[model samples]
Target: MRHTEREPDYIIKNDNALINLENSVKSLCKHVMLRQENEHLKDLVIDRNKYETILGNSTPVMKVLRLIQKVEKSNIMVLVTGQSGTGKELVAKSIHYNSPRARKPFVTVNMGAIPEDLIESELFGHEKGAFTDARDRRIGKFEEANEGTIFLDEIGEMDLMLQTKLLRVLQEKEVTRIGSNKSIKLDVRVIAATNKNLAQEVKEGKFREDLFYRLQGFLIHLPPLFERGDDVVLLSKSFLTDFCKENRMGNITLSKEAVKFLMDYKWPGNVRELKAVIERAAIMSENLTIQPEDLIFANG
Candidate 1:
């Protein structure tokens, strides 16, 4: 039956070939145009105050800013410890963009998101035919980030076996693929972040002590939003302005009631949750200003 169908319907087959040729020509032209446009696209126009754009004059943010300044000139590994939404990644970006390697790639990997079975392969890559799914060779984050910096978020969530592999990479400055016998030298700097207490995890044997020490070359701790005082109101205003511009709404300011509510609320999700609350208010508010009723939190 399949062989009979393989004998092409002569009339329809010629028409199909002609149509495919025309489609191929059109696709080629479209691809060429896109390539030209991409080539003309200007390089990233990064704002100078990108970090400030996220966090305002809060003491917690100031502390992070100071740490970033102190460590930008060094190649030491940095460990940022904080709650989930406490802006650890922002600190990582600020350090990378302000550092000597700013021009190079800034790669981020969420260790907690990768599967336990593939974490090592995902970080160090695998050679072709290394395992069941290894149909093709892969270049891992460590390789992709060579000569640049790699941000490993939620490092505390990595499995004990992978922690040992990571420790080997840090110590040897090299990586060997899962199936490859040869080790490739690496010059990448690593920045790690986690919400868990590594000291406790070390005593529990969940994390390696040596890896924790290596990752803590320059340790930074970020305070939660509740402890940041007046920055709450300041950040609300900033987020309000940004939301207004993004949604093309007329400029709207926060009311006194709204400001007080923001200041009093205990932000469980930190600055991230704060930004979302303001954006929600900006979208849902019908009045010229964001009133306390317009804020969408349980307390607001």
Candidate 2:
């Protein structure tokens, strides 16, 4: 007679053990995710501190620093408005380097530098044979900046037609190559900088009103050097120290008269002009201190 196969009661017990194992694995995964998030927060804090050191502690600069701290964690579009040389690109860098996507690429495109004919191809890329000169497939700024950030400098200079395309990118998060009918999806964060007043450009009909609104989700206006009060002197000293260190020269100090002249003259080129002036003074100074005569003004 054939013996009946034994039905093991431990099968039910084994099912319970499997459920416990699954629960334990889920708990471990949750713990790992939480730890990663905490590390990211810690990195963000460190980045904020680094930016604080770069941007001085003057009231206006401090205000901007605080704003950077608030916005760096989010992926919102930012519009930085200031005169040329006011460190708009620096501000963009600070944001990107502090965000969750800090490790990703930070692509910068100078809207004013590209020719009108090639601007579209430069931004949205092209197929290998898209244009007459097309020898190889080219990736666009948006694609290069996938899952990262794209800084559009001199955004006001973008043509009206291109503005529409950019607006579509911001809305749809996708781009189509010039010769291809297919659209490539992107996860790019846009940060635009402009020396021109986009509001004025919009009113003047030179800029698209819709695009202006889209880009200006959060606006940061960098004050000119003259308006920054004591920041001029602070920045001058900082630049001097940097120049000295870079050249392997002894420490250089700015003379009282040199400080007076720097404070008195308006910096038309903003911080960039100030940096250039200080660098020149550092190089030209025969003594350890920068004298008034050593400080040359471009306007003069």
The CA lDDT of each predicted structure is 0.85, 0.89
lDDT of 1 by residue, 1-300 (tens): 876786678657998999999999999999999987764541241245244545668776787778888997789999999887888988888787777777667889999898888888889999999999999999999999998889999999998888888899998999999899999999898899999999999999998888888887899998889999999998888888877888889898888888898898999888889988899898877777888888887443
lDDT of candidate 2 at residue 255, scale 0 to 100: 89
In Å, residue 10's CA in model 2 sits off its true spot by: 49
In candidate 2, what are the lDDT values of residues 95-148, reduced to their tens digit? 988888887778999999998999899999999988899899999989999999
- What is candidate 2's CA lDDT for residue 122? 91
**Number of the top lDDT candidate:** 2
Q: How high is the lDDT of residue 178 in model 1?
A: 88
